[model samples]
Target: MLIIFIICILALNPIAATENSSDWKTQKVENVNFKLAPQYENGELVNSKYYTIKNMFIFSIRYIDSDSFLKSSYGDDASSEDTHYIKNKNIKGHNSSIIYQERNIDGVKYNTTYIYFPIKDEIYCISYNGSNITQDIEEMIKNTPKQTMSEKKFYSKLTHATVSYEYSQREENSYNDYYYRTPYQYNNQNKNQWGKYYLAYSLGRSSRYYY
Candidate 1:
């Protein structure tokens, strides 16, 4: 009788097959909606540029095919990292290794973290970097909901979804043509050297700096 009941339950709640990333289910958690972006190569998802949302945060998710590939991409950082800080955290019920690195870009110092974890047969690389870090961004990892098989489809869609963006605000500073000063720099000298300071702005918690 128990065996029969188990069989009935299995038949009723059949496992959902994995689908491509394009068809993955999207859900909103903590007022943020996460949708999969397709950009993969050789069965691995690799987005050259991050997807920025809300003008303050940026994120990227990549799929690693095998342990061999994971080592190839993260050989030095995973093992012989003598300078940066490395640690582990339980994320989404999985033990994820986190590595911190810092570098100066255009005179601005930016902090970054590389988070690596495995799910089933493949590994995931989730990373974020910015001039400032916040608790909300840190919570993003912990609060991510466990996805179903159908939701996993979004990750697979990245293989064919690597289309380039015509103009993304995230990459606005990269192009040289976008800069034009109004009212002239000479005229603004009398003005505050740091002009247009706002009275109020949101403050985010700072992450650990490399050095």
Candidate 2:
């Protein structure tokens, strides 16, 4: 009976591995390409690539045009007491700007980092929500190559249409839940209320995507 139970567990291990492997697919947004699993928020698919490591941290990547990058706000968070920006930092041969933010949500503190770098006409952003930056995350950043239209155009295809970039805002009275507001919303209503808590909230949430 012991040997039979052990064989049953071994047989099920491959099935679980296959299911997890099938969840990820190659996705390309604008000029950047990467592998991501389909993540949903409120039953809708999001517009970024994300991978969760050990169920503790989430690493996501997104890119937008230079025009959008300049127009959007990065710093200035009213909700978070600690927010810092380090500019012209070198990461894997790319000069990047890093945003380190900390927020207290429902008595829990969350730490998030955003690494921004320009690749040709677009600005690529890699974000991680965790206290410590692990070696695997560093490896992912180091291995992130410059993807262009002229390179491997036949093999890589754009998976989703580019949406106008907008900064995220945390929903009122919610833990780890956030909603994105367009540039027009900010301009017309709360332009001065732009913050990084939304970005932190969106990424810190369980398996949510962001642009």
Winning model by TM-score = 2
lDDT of 2 by residue, 1-211 (tens): 9999999998877444235533445455455544443341112124443323322114556564434343342323212347654444555555565666776667876677766555543556666676454444444445456533232321121101112221332323233333456667547554333334466576685323332
- Write the residue-wise lDDT of candidate 1 on 1-211 in tens digits: 9999999988875532212333543433222343433221112222332233311113555555544455444444444333277665656554566767665557866466667554443355565664332343334444454433332442332212222121232355454333554456546653543232311122232222211
Residue 139 of candidate 1: its Cα lDDT? 40
- TM-scores, in order shown? 0.37, 0.42
The model with the greatest lDDT is 2
Question: Following a full C-alpha superposition, what root-mean-square deviation does model 2 have from the true structure?
Answer: 19.3
Off by over 4 Å in 2: 1-25, 35-45, 48-58, 66-69, 75-81, 85-87, 106-108, 147-211
Runs in model 1 with CA error above 4 Å?
1-58, 79-83, 105-108, 130-211
Residue 190 C-alpha lDDT in model 1:
35
Q: Assess candidate 1 and give its lDDT.
A: 0.44
